[model samples]
Target: MGLGKLLHDHAEHADVGGTIDHPRAYELAAEIGFLGRRREIFTRLAALSGVRPGDRVLDVGCGTGYLTRILAPIVSPAGRVTGVDASAPMVEHARRRAPGNCSYQVGEGQALDLPDAGFDVVVSSLAVHHIPAAERGAALREMFRVLRPGGRLLIAEFRPPTNHLLAQLVGMVSGPAMRHSPHDLLGDLIPAAGFHVQDEGDLPVMLSYVRALRPST
Candidate 1:
């Protein structure tokens, strides 16, 4: 079985990409996959999110609350960071490590339980491809719905390496989900969801990101 299949819970919807059940194993894999630069990379992601000290932030598919933990200190004192994931186990694991300003719940990206226009920022990292392809549009729409006008959004996804051998190796390990080019995976989804595209570019460590804003008007 591929590493992805090994880490994924088979009980989850077969149509969905997969939900990780083993938090510790997933954490270890993430650390290894990122080459021990997970913290620095995630810190950059948090910065790209355009979150402020008083901005309410939401993290969709927040595996192990890694990004949420990074965001908590940024949105400290008064602001709150809420993380939602499809895996109950992952949510529970996140809850155990959550900071004072962070919280977590079991939820899916396509059908968020959050209120409309409730968040100033929404960020999802390495999570979009996990949503079933049919539901990805709905998930983007949900992100649009939960953000206040002019709210920022940052989405980061895996970028397959340019080297053919390395890309194939990544596919073999992570499954087909990570094999897609971020541009092809996200094409028109953000704009179709009513977000104004701000910037998009490749980041270090085989990551690609898109930043957008909810229209103020």
Candidate 2:
């Protein structure tokens, strides 16, 4: 079995790409996948999010709440960070590790059970490709729906290495879901969903990100 299959629970949500049920194992894999720089890379992601103190933030597909933990301090005391994932086990694991200002729930990204325009910022990482390919558009729309007008969004996804051999190796280990170039994976979804894309670029350790905002008007 590929490492992706090993870490995922295919039997649970067969319609969805794959739901990772083993939080501890997923955590270890993420650490190894990032080559011990998960924190550093995620910190940059948080910065790119343009989150401020007292800003209400939402994390979609927040596996194990790793990014939420990094964001907790920044939005602490007054602001809050809410994490949503499809897997109950993953949500439970994140709840255990959640800080006082952070909370978690079991929910789908394509059909979020959140109020419209409720969040100041919304971020999703390595989560879009996990949604069924047909539903990715809905998921991006949902992200736009939940964020207040003028709210910021940051989406980070795995960028396959440029080297052919390394890219094939990544595919073998992680499965086909991660093999897509971020541009192809995202396409015009952000703009189609009503987001004004601000910037996008590659990050170290094979990551790519797009920053966008909901128009205030």
Candidate 3:
């Protein structure tokens, strides 16, 4: 199959944004060389989500459904999990690799077809950087629209300049695509998009996270 078909097919399983070949969080999971770290991260995201029985869940930019599938059991039989991404191949891979309780959708972060207040939790990892810097805020607004009151947004990304020379150097070795993202700025942007920032933490310096909650209007 052609590259496009491969990517599309993968999107059927995971959340892939576009043709851009960017370094994803899975790469870190791979470097860890085990599902344990991935599972740990997924669990943290799920627990932080505050998902309850019968609560609908949306995994925005849910690459490979790692976190999305983990949420399936939390939401339980009554609740549902929808994973939206832009690539067919990623989504396809996610579908094949994930549990049956989760479903996948092909779409952009800036425009989701899901209804207003449709999800109890929306989490994305290493996806905001792939989107154009100008479009990141817009995409965040879209995430807000689909969330139910009291829903939470958790985003994890690599903070830059921790080792600026090292990152650029690694980019040189792994090619430009391996370069780190501007994870530092997201904390400020989250509130600007309307959510209330609840906590901000770091993961071994290179990775940082921001958690925000939507207050009932």
Best-matching candidate per lDDT? 2
Every model's TM-score: 0.95, 0.95, 0.77
Better of 2 and 3 by TM-score: 2
Give lDDT for model 2. Answer: 0.89
- How many backbone overlaps does candidate 1 show? 0
Across residues 1-217, which tens digit of lDDT does each residue of candidate 3 receive? 4332332322221222243232243445334532246566557767766778887878777766677778888888888889987766567778887676789988878888888888888888656755555667888998889888888888876555456676664433222223445444453678877898898776543556788998887
Residues 1-217, model 2: lDDT tens digits: 6576677545324235767788888888889888899999999999999999999999999999999999999987899999999999999999999899999999999999999999999999998878887899999999999999999999998898989998877665566556678888889999999999999999988999999999999
Compared with the true structure, all predictions reach lDDT values of 0.88, 0.89, 0.67
Clashing pairs in 2: none
| Sequence-dependent TM-score of model 3 | 0.77
TM-score ranking, best first: 2, 1, 3
RMSD of each: 1.9, 2.0, 5.6
State the lDDT at 8 in candidate 3. Answer: 31
> Per-residue lDDT for 1-217 in model 1, tens only?
5566667644234236667788888898789888899999999999999999999999999989999999998998799999999999999999999899899999999999999999999999988888887889999999999999989999999998999987777665566566678987888999999999999988887899999999999
